[model samples]
Target chain A: MNKRELIRRTAIEIIAEEGYYNTKVQIIAEQAEIAVGTVYNYFSNKEEILNYIFKVEFDKRLDILKRLKVEAISFKEKLNLFLEEHFQELETNPATTSVLVQESQLPRKHSLKAVDDFINELPELLAEMIESAKKKKEIRDVNSSLIANAIFYTIRGMASKVVLNEHYNFDQTKEELMNLLWCGIKN
Target chain B: MNKRELIRRTAIEIIAEEGYYNTKVQIIAEQAEIAVGTVYNYFSNKEEILNYIFKVEFDKRLDILKRLKVEAISFKEKLNLFLEEHFQELETNPATTSVLVQESQLPRKHSLKAVDDFINELPELLAEMIESAKKKKEIRDVNSSLIANAIFYTIRGMASKVVLNEHYNFDQTKEELMNLLWCGIKN
Candidate 1:
């Protein structure tokens, strides 16, 4: 892995274990086998490193959501596809998923703009999908903005357990979440 | 109100405005117009003051859930009743509601047992409700424990908006959350 990727991977492991507040830049550098100054060259501060992780994750999801938006699929298909992509990542990258769940609320409290923007922007993208599906008369006329946010909340809450539970079957969770969210939009 | 009640209310207001970490015991006592010694007489420290607020709120919901448990209502009816009681309190006590939504995640990091217990136990109580309903065939057969946690997450996420939106129509929010959670448990 490259130096920047190494720093991020090490940071995720430490943050997942000790939490964001308990983590330090020096520790991340030592674990990454790099000089502390090299860590600074990549990230201005500890908060920025966390923000970078969020940005990287957010961009990936944004790309996925954008591609799904014009796939000519039904709303239900879109939801299932989106959730599968999301939960699969939680299974493969459990450490990063743990960081996302544990530190997500911190953005609301601590002004972590990348995390905040990711959480906020995601629902808007989902809302647009809901709105388009309603226009196509493929779904019920529930409040798009509200239901999108609720669906996002469900994903985060269930994903928390997926990370924390060693034997979690994420496919089951994805189905349950999809069923509940589909109810909000289905006629 | 009693001295403890006074401190609780005053702390909620300051914590809501400046956040829990930013607010101090002296600020709460000064705002309450009580001597610092008088404040300490009732609560041991700032952390305890917040815990006391959480305990009071948790007990209220616990009573509501317990009462609903024995009532001969359908699962849907029980959910409506519980949600009405919970959301109505948010309308009347947005400050405390704000504190609950904002500081709730702190317990996982900090040692605030009341808040932790409140969040943890509510799901178990709801899970019991779900299990009972499933046996009677009043609700769909699903993972009761997982769905219960998802329901609580919906309430907290929607309630966060209820506190932040000064002109929020909580009745609508309550209904939206109800519909989504009902979707989870309903056949």
Candidate 2:
């Protein structure tokens, strides 16, 4: 991995173990096997490192979603693919997922705006997908942004359950969520 | 009005303004116009103050839901009444709502377990409502816990939107959500 990625992975491990409030930049530097000054070369402080971690992960997901948007697949297929990939990513990186989910809820400090920007991108991407699906008549004419926000929070809530409750089965939960979104709760 | 309530209100103001990590016990004591020792007399520390804030707010909602459960109202009506009150509470106390929503996402710190317990109560209450509705054939026979979680997250997502985006209309969004839940999203 590159230096930036190395630093981030190290930070995620530490932050996940010691809550973000307890984590320090020097510790991350030591864990990454880099000098303290070298860490500064990439990230100015601990919050920036945290922000970078979220930004990198979110950017990767955005890239995949953008690519899927152009594919000649039905909206349902696209959504399923996205959900599957999203859950799989979380399952593999529980530590990072924990940090991202928890830290995003922190107060809107000016310092965390970069992280907030990255966090906000998910709903915007979901909104785009909904709008595209609406144009193609694949889904009902609903409020795309509202639906997007709902979908984003649904996934977030599921992720929180998966992380907090050991009994939560990721695959089964994903299938149930898809069914609810596609067919909904009403009989 | 009481001493504990005074401390909690003061903590909410500080925590809401400065975020949880940045707020100190001394500051909360000063704002509450009580001695630091007196603050500890009411609670152990800052975390307890925060937990009390959430517990007080959640208890009120849970009490209403429990009372509604025994009434002769339909499940849909119960659900609508519960949601209307929920949104109205958030609207009237945006600062406390912000703190509750944001702080609940913090890492699983032992100090915050009371807050976590209070936070988990909502989903459990929702699951009870869903299971009851299913028994009465008010809703479909589906995974009650999953649907409960979905509805909880949907409301959470809407709450976050109302708090973050200035243009979001709480009443209209609540209506859209009720429509989406009552009549499934499928066309």
Candidate 3:
């Protein structure tokens, strides 16, 4: 892997275990097998490195959603595919999920710029898709941004559990969530 | 209000405006119109004070949920009544909701014990209700704990918005959410 990519992956692991406040640039450099000076070349400070992590992750999801928007599949198919990708990514990289869910909740002084952007933009992106779905009568007229936000939190709450708990089965989690999103729990 | 309640109210306001790390006991004491030592007499430390806030808030909701369990109402009615109370509380006391949602998300060093309990216990409480509802066949075969967690996050996400925005109508917000929750967005 490239030096910058190596540093990024190393930081995720250390930050996941030690947390952002406890993590140091020197430790990340040593763990990545690079000089601290070289680390500084890629990231201005620890916060910058952390922000880079969120920016990369959020951007990946946004790209996938954007790509799905143009596909011939129904909005339901799009959502299912996106959720599958998102959850599987979290399931495989629990460390990154842990860091993403946790660090984004820090107070402003410690909060990352990208984290704030994700908080604002990810829902908007989803809302856009929901809006289009409503227009096509693919889904009922549920408020777009509101439903988007609900879905966002549901994923976060579930992903947080996936990182800490082992009992969550993949198909089960997705099916239950999809049921609530598509057909409410009202018997 | 009593002296202890005065301190709690003042602390919530200050902590809401300034992030938790930025708020000090002395400031809370000054704002509460009490002596610093007097504040200590009631609470051991700032963390304890924060924990008390979460403990009281979580217990209030738990009480309502427990009370609802014994009522003759269906799980659907029980959930609606509980959500109305929960959202109305947040709407009226935006400051408290702001603190509860934001503070509970802080890292371990800064995390409050009661916040942890609220996060862990609230979902379980809801799961118990869902489990009982399932037994009665009042709801579908959806996983109890899974739906409970989903509802928990959905509330958190929506409550997070209520604190920051003023455009959300009480009826609109509740209706949209109850619709997605009671009867999902499927056309």
Candidate 4:
């Protein structure tokens, strides 16, 4: 891996292992087998490291929705694809998931803004999906933003549970949750 | 009001103005027009003050739900009452709502535990509602805990939105959300 990639991966590991507070710059440098000065060359500081990790993960998940085949798809299929892709990632990357869940807990100012920006984009997408579904007369005429938020929150909340619940199989929960959302939205 | 009540109210105002951290015990005591030591007799610490506020608000909302005639009501009515009550509280008490939202963001053990406990009860309560609805044959057979969670997350997500979009009339949105949930669960 390149210097920047190494720094980023190592940073995720440290933060995952020790959390935000205990993961220090010097420690990250040692873990990554790079000098503290080399760490500074690639990124500004710990916050920047965190911001980059969040953006990378956020973009990766957001792309799943954006790149899906939107034309001639059932709403059930659309939702299934959304939840499965999102939850699978959480299962694979528990560290990143934990960070996303707890990152907002910090007293930082920008985390909410970042999360809000992520949330704001969902409604327009849902509106498009709803418009198409309405043309098919598949569901009731409803406020798309509200529907979008409902779906978003359902998955988000379930994702949190998946992260925290060690004994529960999220795959099963995801299937059940997808069924509920589909049953709720479909005509 | 008594000193204890005064401190609780003052703490709410202070938290509303300066956020959870910025609003200190000293500031609350000052606003309550009492000595800082006097505040101690009423609250063991800031966290205790917050817990008290949460229990009071949560129980008050629960009491409202308990008193409603859900037993004799239609499933739609039962769900509508549940959604509207939550939306109305989110509108009326944005300050407490704000604190609760922020608390969910905290990485501290206590904050995480408190949020978990708050959400844990919801699934059981919702499961009860869903069970009743199913026996009435108001909806299809589904996993009550799973469906209840889906419904709960939807409401929680919308409530968070109400807090963020202060001027947005959540009543209409809430109506739409309830309708969606109702549609999803119905035969």
Best-fitting candidate, scored by DockQ: 4
Residue range B1-187, candidate 4, lDDT tens digits: 8887888788887887787767789989888889999999978899888877777767665665565535687877877887778777877887777776666554364463335566787566778878887887989887777777777778777777767765446788787787778877786
Best by TM-score: 1
**Candidates sorted by DockQ, best first:** 4, 3, 1, 2
TM-score of chain B of each: 0.89, 0.88, 0.88, 0.89
| C-alpha DockQ of every model | 0.46, 0.34, 0.57, 0.58
C-alpha lDDT of residue A164 in model 2? 72
Per-candidate TM-scores read 0.93, 0.83, 0.92, 0.89
Q: How close is candidate 2 to the true structure, as a TM-score?
A: 0.83
Off by over 4 Å in 2: A13-31, A98-111, A184-187, B6-40, B44-47, B94-114, B184-187
Query: Which of 1 and 4 is the better model by DockQ?
Result: 4
How do the residues A56-97 of candidate 4 rate in per-residue lDDT, one tens digit apiece? 777776777776536467766776887888888888987788
> How would you encode candidate 1's per-residue C-alpha lDDT over A1-187 as one tens digit per residue?
9989999999999998888888999899999899999999988899899888888888889888999999988988998999999888778987888888776445345567786797789989999999999898888767788878878877877888766665457998888778777775677
Cα misplacement distance, residue B27 of candidate 3 (Å): 2.2
Q: What's the lDDT for residue A77 in model 4? A: 74
List the candidate 4 regions with Cα displacement exceeding 4 Å: A69-72, A109-113, B65-70, B104-109, B112-114
Q: Count the backbone clashes (under 3 Å) in each candidate.
A: 0, 0, 1, 3
lDDT, candidate 4, equals 0.75
For residue A158, give model 1's deviation from the true position in Å: 1.1
Q: Quality of candidate 3's docking, in CAPRI categories?
A: medium
DockQ score of the complex predicted as candidate 1: 0.46
lDDT per residue (tens digit) for residues B86-143 in model 3: 8888778878887886764465656677877877888899999888888887777778
Interface RMSD of 4: 2.4
Candidate 1, residue B184: lDDT: 53
| lDDT against true structure, model 2 | 0.78
